[model samples]
Target: MKYQFFWITVLLIFSLSACKSIQEKANDQFLSGQYQYAINSYSQILENEPDNLEANQAVAESYRLSNRVEQAGPYYEKLVEEEPTFENVYRLGLSLKAQQKPAEAKAAFEKAKGYTQNETYLAETQRQIEAINLSEGIEDYFPNYELVNYTELNTAGADYAPVISENFMYFTSGRRASGIYPADGSPYTKLFRTRAEGLRVDVGNIQTLPEFQNEEGLNQAAIAISPDGNTIIYARGNSTSPKDLPETALFASYFRGAGFTQPIWLPVNEDETWWNSTPAFSPDGEELYFASNRPGGFGGIDLYKATKLANGDFGNAVNLGPNVNTPGNELFPRMTADGKFFFSSDGHPGYGKLDLFVAEKGADGNQVIKNLGENFNSPSDDFGIFFSNYPKEGFISSNREGGAGDDDIYFFEDKTPKPKIVNVLLNVFTKQRVAGEPDAVLEQARVVLYDSSNDQEGGDFSNSNGRVRFTLEPNADFTIIASKGGYFSKSIPYTTRGKTPNPEDLIQEVTNITLDTTIVLDQLILDKSIVLENIYYDLDKADIRPDAAVELDKLVQILKDNPSIKIELSSHTDDRSSDEYNQDLSQRRAQSAVDYIVSQGISADRLVAKGYGESQLIIENATTEEEHQTNRRTEFKVIEIQE
Candidate 1:
């Protein structure tokens, strides 16, 4: 439900004329969020008193509130050019930003900065500039992700705020229900759900969640379920009644064996205030994060987290502080498993209305906030993101373009390269040498991944499905090694080298790739040669560059893992240089790599360096630079293995 209140300065059109009743009615309409009606009334007053300051301002504000931002641009432009008040220039900047003319909006903010003596206004203008820069550079925020509309779950009314539990996808909707909300004439919002197939939900089989519909006429929305899927907390708002007074509160329900228990008032809600709603629980169930317009907030609606006491009640709600909450409404706080905090805010520089943002502490322990970018956001509201598991695949709610109704749900996955990852699945198997023989699943196999670039190692055992899962970083080369007691160990290397964002995508989003790979293991054999690719040195130089170090580190790790194996480290050069010079340079390159591996704690006695100098060329008579580059290589062969 849309709350009725002025986000900007409230206007009171005081006139000493007989038409004061008309002006009062217009002010009442604007305050009640009836912007179109307010526009008509204000325009009638402006026809007679064209120069009336109150009437002109009210008309401009109405045009803005009704999402007709372009219509309000001229009035603000005129107002600022005449007497540039902070409110006029700031609102003008917003109008320009809404119209996609961010350059003009930035300029308007600059002008507003000069006109205001208040520090809050100055800081807000700077934030608007930051928002414009972020808007222009969206790929930086979200790198490699695709968003798909939840066509199955959406209706012709409003369908949003999807939460996943077991096989069901729970959400809130205002479709053709039994009763209509007097405030908006839409059907009263109710809890609904359907079957979930991974990220794709089965919309053809939608049904209402029967437990919470006992209330005759109320709007239900913004639900959060515990990780264990036992308890549910949702927002319930009554229809606009003289007794209800447009108030909303959070309610908690326990999941019984068959159905949900009777919902009762959540302890953190305040009865006097009408703005409390949209409750979310932390993953650990230790804290509750909720939105409220209670007194002493930054402004509008601010997010507050309450501690769950030992007595099963909540303690005093604490504001999330300026780090998360802003003067604009900060609603829908969802915490990921990795401690990332996701929320929606209009106060931040956004596309328009409300935009989804994620915040987390970086390695340096400072809070890092970023928008989800244009793919997940639009000119309207986008909030209520549900992660199946953080940094993997999940769903989000949006009232963006080309939707089935006012608000629709969308699914998104992480596509960017990172050091830490989530939701990566691998299938482990072993192949027999006999032709046409099917590979057998390698259950109970030990799978270990060594990140050569970062020197991190993680291991997991293959399950009954021959599946092993892991979270990985995207910025490194990984050596995936799999082994079982009776089978020979095999190793394969994978790199994220070519998975970087395109130049245009740099400002838009990070790329997330969902991988389902089969790792084939061969029986162990002696005298096997493992060639390391992309370990090239500069012409006439034996020093390693950053890229070469990444590959060389893999060799270092291989030597460290098979500590009892003595190996020969060899280097080959293209035939361009003279044999003496090439041999000498190649020897130095081999020695240099051996020394580097020894620096990483590999035993020096177990290694030998040799210069092949094109003697063992894989491609003889190579004419192209590509072929010549391939001839310049490095390899390590196991000469001896101690039992």
Candidate 2:
């Protein structure tokens, strides 16, 4: 009787194991975001039962959810062709659209639209068709920019999430020689530091941070440094599962005398139920922002900020609300010094995958979201934007094509941005000074504005009345030069510096300003020296002043425009000082001006520096203060014009 019972128990155990269905196993993996595993399970079921509708549908969905929508297309096409159900047809069209086959996707959507009885779904299908048609010819949204891939900091594996502190940049990378993690079968990510000098990053000093490593397994990669550079916060996982969907929490470390202390998990983490990562500190260093899948959030992962207490512990975390968080993930939350918040989301209408976005208050005190556009975002993942005190230039992490690794860091500069404006006009004109008549218009002269910082030049010839109207960017500086044949070039220093509205207003409101100005050029006469205006120095010093830089820039442009022209930069001083001292001071001032021009990329061999002290005063026997001021000036004489 005992032997029979033991055999019966063994048979019952085997039966129970075989009774577990493939659909149940696939469902478990699908819910856990292990789509690859789910795909394998469903594909196994379809191999034995090819026409199993449930298995085929699950297999297609697994491919779509895993960002392998191209692999789902064949399955969806076959299912729709055989079943022709409204749901199947609609899904087939979506799969085609994800592969960028808009025409075919539209045909599938139209076919599905005819079969759907639900009015809401039919309307949604029609909207998708219109959107696809519009996107077929969509223009790039952001201004032209230069993106520099930091190849020096990238490796054959993944590298991303960059944060700058002082002269060093801290980021995450899977470049270690240690073998791939058992989970995910990819190189484990660790914290790395290297020197970042503007856009020229160096990899020679790339070092894996020891204090932030996970000895037992792979640690989290996303990290944030404090404003004072003394503390760091990062994410860490508790499990070493192959799915890599371990329970994660945030941890903090302090920079002690020579190295960082052991990391300590923060108190804000839930009791092993939530997954947390991507920690960022506010510019003020008072709030810590991170992404969490905690309950009570708006569905998917939501961004939360916790206030720092006086005792160094975090307070209760607060949700960022719906303006920024969405039904999809709101990850990599970063704040610029100006209080503009940026994050990444897939729930928003984007070019598939994740896209970067900025959230701010509009003029009406409501939230406004702005997409960074294709220049900074791609169909692949783009997130983790970090600004260096200012927002004009910064670094971003992307998994776009042609990268050195899975996710590489890129630097961008908006040097000559066409800022959003409202009704600002630039009136270009030429002045013809006459003793008795109003300054007559000198038409047909060329008016050019050059931003030397960016090497961007734009201009137009004067109209019939010598007036060419246009607009310009605010809070920028430019050199406006007016020139014509037989005319000595005239340079006007222009600045669009004005008090900008609040951040919210700047995002939505436009300022109106009408600038009415005149540019004058004199007829060139041989051997005549023209005094460069606003060229001044300190009372007894020879250093070039800020005012002098503006004037010297114009001389640099002149040498560039007339490439073959040679000139002499001369400086003069008043007779108040001793003759010897005056001569020495003026010589230093002339050389300083010449050096400034040379720094602007002009050839040193094409110019000469001369000091004609009080000996060659403009106002001889000067007695009045105004006369002495006139003698203290700088001028450039055209020595030779090869043309």
Candidate 3:
């Protein structure tokens, strides 16, 4: 009998120890923000002791934090059903409201009224019911999005960045269509064109750009077309060179009025190093904008711009500055015919991952960017958005739930009211060196402008001049190109001032651009290279000031005319700071120029950005501010031939 009693005692001790261990774990998890785990533990205890009010209540609280209000509703209802107390009834009603069952929720609130007669909870519940009723009457401003894959087109590896133009849709995918390099030896992302047709559902018939294929790995995305559908600009990375990842740049090809022209790399100054991406053209095709991670931006990636000049050259680039850029990555910008800018971002607070945002030119011409709201966004990643100016239909790429693949393209329609017209100016120019003059004469060249930024054809060049001028609707960005034999072909950097057109300014003002003559081997051999003496920056700040904009803009024009040119962005800093910091600072400064060019619609791939920091100081042991400024300078170098 004593032995039996000893065994019973031992069993009792063990059971108590297990219970303590479970409770301790539950408490620890609860305090550590592991509410789901805590709820599971508490549930185990409640299963053994159904009437354990504390364990039951803990489960309810956990459910609330986890956004599982429907699960919490039953537990609270049971507590009220058994006790019929004012507190229990009120809690039950609250849970029902949270679950969004307004009619049933109201019934629970009415029951609570019988117990408490509290006017505040009664009024709040009544208000909630009314709000729900109101919300039901209004259509969800944001449409539900789902990604559908064209399995007939996509292969085993990757697919993304879809763009629609006229009857055809173009996208960058990793399919092994003819001319595509294999995944193992030569990895590349190529531009695939497809004809998409349908109303409620559309099917895309895919075809690869055979003529533009390169042996290098291609990371292509963010495509744009000219208004006449004769030119195309797309982003590309070095896929053929595996060691060269994240070195993606932008490239352009003419549609030949029949098929695509041979693809060519845009040029940059020799000193800078950075990757460019996401080319968007204004309606007139005079300006281009793209994103880059080069230095001098407010943060990671910033937008920049370049212009087409009279000499059939692209002028220098300008940074878009803080108004349109932030510390986080700003990418995939699309312009509407009305001059509104659309892009995806994670820096701004919204529903989740990367939310779609619209920025319009404010009355003062500054960009005012705003979130589209919760109905259009979720906790998952949303990106690569495009919109049509006509039917107003749009598509976005996302990895959210209900996608056909890893990243599916979602089609959506905008129900929001059409934006009002704001008149803006579109300009194009070219440069030609006068026979006897040292300066190049900026004159009208044959300019073709397209509104690929907003996925709409705005206007075409029926006129000849280095300059093509037109009234741009507000909320639009455009791409402008100029071509003449013997003179290099040039493209305008993408730009959007986002301003309401002042008729007064439009009446007399003209957006002027000057392209320069192509530097033949003879002329280039004479000078070889030119040093940019004025690419300056302030103390400790990488922000590109207006003065720097003037010079960089000039360099961009030079590249535009000579499509075969490739350049590098380089930075040098004084020896005052730590080498690492100086290197970083110099890199930032160099990137600032690259950012400016990209915002102008120069592709990131054309430019390579590097920072020598104090290592390449021009003025060693300089003590003066001017000397330090000399040391802390930025420069560019030509890298490759685009021809």
Candidate 4:
């Protein structure tokens, strides 16, 4: 028995040693930028100990560093709830943004601002929060661009940078030989061509380019053909070591009579690479545009212009100036035949690290940069746009979730969204219902408006004319409450679903129509019996009817809205039964109503049930059946007003 126990201890020690060794390996991989391998190792640990904070965080960071933010969201969500450090919270916000959850992402970023004292981090967090806000309502300005995709072309690898020319599509894909790049775990990219018709590509014929263009052990991609299709350019490079920066540069090949020439680096890069890439040619082929991270630039990667010489070489490069550059990256500069300039930027106010933007001439003739908005951009890397057909059809690339790969090519078309020119406005009036006179405008009455979700949208006090106007969204339901001192609060519903004017019927750019509603509040007089409408009871029983319960619900809302006021709910009966029997029935009916209200989350102390019996009647001697039926009614009177 002693020998067996000693063997068990020895086995336990070996198991623990193996576990520790694996954990150390995962940590090493994470530190060395082998995020994919780290992710797999940490995931194995998490399978046994799901709540391990270190393992969860390692997995989350692995996915994030690998540029798969959508995959990191669940882990970060759990980690934020478990251990909300600044990094976890900030990364969680990024994950939320990648999932297109702007509101929640903004909230997380706002919260993260409080956990850090570093000014740069705080500034970035605030900027992202403002970007989320700025992104709202921008889509309304541009025509909706619809993206279409085919299933057969997209693979588990990154496929992007599509350019169409002469009935063929040239793009880039990282699906080569299952070789992995530790930084992102994607294979080396290669340029590929396929038969195409406008926006559609024939995936079955897709094949890699000749060996000269697709050199082994290196990443080469993009064949951004010029407007004339005679010149083709692409980005080529990859890091040889993990500790070194990637050696990306722009390489071009000219289309001679029958075939292409050997590719070489553009002279503008000086043949010494420092992140120069994503080359584009102007419509007239006079100016070549490219993004570079060379020294003496406005930002990390600025768009630069170089004039094409007569000898077919690009001359000295000039930065596109601050108007088109920032402290962050600006890449994938694409120009349309009509002189419209479009690109992707991480420096602008956008939903994420990179967003598609267009530079348009303003009314003052100055350049105006505008984000393409949510319809054309996601909270992911969206770039490499090509105008296969300008303003009508084009192509873009994105790493957004739901794509078939890390990055996928998409076809976009100008759908020309319908003009939303109908303006919906509401003019609400608060009035006092006089006993014997017309409704009198109740000035200074407080009016609060709530949406269908019961969330308060806006509030105002009635003006001198007892009118309050609210801007309502199209096709929405709202509840308005009007209340004043010495008056009972009233609630009214207004819907603009079918009542709104047809947008097409409007002649001007925007047509404004005002909807009118009134909330008639009754005077809150003591001992005044305010009859509840349609309060019915079972024959000879005190049981509340379904219809009666419906009416009672309105009273419940009033009680909740005016918490300081208490009321006495009383029931009346006609002089058909004896006084004792009538009193019993009336008391039971009144008590049933009070019980019903209490069941609906109302305080019991606010309600008092009273049996009026046949003592109080609207008609002292009812000779007609209609008058007798009126005598048997339920009413509530204001008994007490508490502070």
**After superposition on all CA atoms, how large is the RMSD of candidate 2?**
20.6
lDDT of 3 by residue, 508-551 (tens): 44433222222211122221234577887877889989998999
Reference-based lDDT, residue 255, model 4: 81
Quick one: how many clashes does candidate 4 have? 0
Q: How close is every model to the real structure, measured as TM-score?
A: 0.60, 0.55, 0.39, 0.56
| Total clashing pairs for each candidate | 26, 1, 114, 0
Kindly report which residue stretches of model 2 are placed more than 4 angstroms away from their true locations once superposed: 1-71, 76-98, 101-142, 177-185, 241-246, 256-258, 415-643
Question: lDDT of all the models against the reference?
Answer: 0.77, 0.78, 0.63, 0.84
1-643: candidate 4 lDDT, tens digit per residue = 9999999999999999989988998999898777888988888899999999999998998897666776799899889889888889998988887677888999999999888999978987886777778777566325667887545788888898888778888888987643676666678788888888877778888888752457766677756677787788888776556443346788888888878888877777774648888888888878888889998887778998899888988888999888888766899898777667899997777867688898888999999889888877777888988877777787889887789977898888888765967777899988899988999999999999999999999999999999999988878899898888998887888888997777776668777878898888888888898999899887899887898999999999888778889899999999998999999999999999999999999999999999999989889889888998899999999899987
Evaluated with lDDT, which candidate comes out highest? 4
Tell me the tens digit of each residue's lDDT in model 2 across 1-643. 9999999999999867754666788778767655667777878878878887777887788777655565688888778878888888887887776666778989999999888789977977886677566554434434675567878777778888898888888888887635454323357677888788766567788887755565445556798988998888998773446565457888889888988888887887855668889999998898989999999987478999999999876768999997787666789999876677889875555554567888878899887877777788776778988875466677889878899857898888875645556555778788665446777788889888777484446788898899877677666777787888767677777776673343335654466667867976665555668789889898889898888898898889777766767889999999998999999999999999999999999999988999988888878888999999899989988787777
Using alpha carbons, what is the TM-score of model 4? 0.56
**What is the alpha-carbon lDDT for the whole of candidate 2?**
0.78
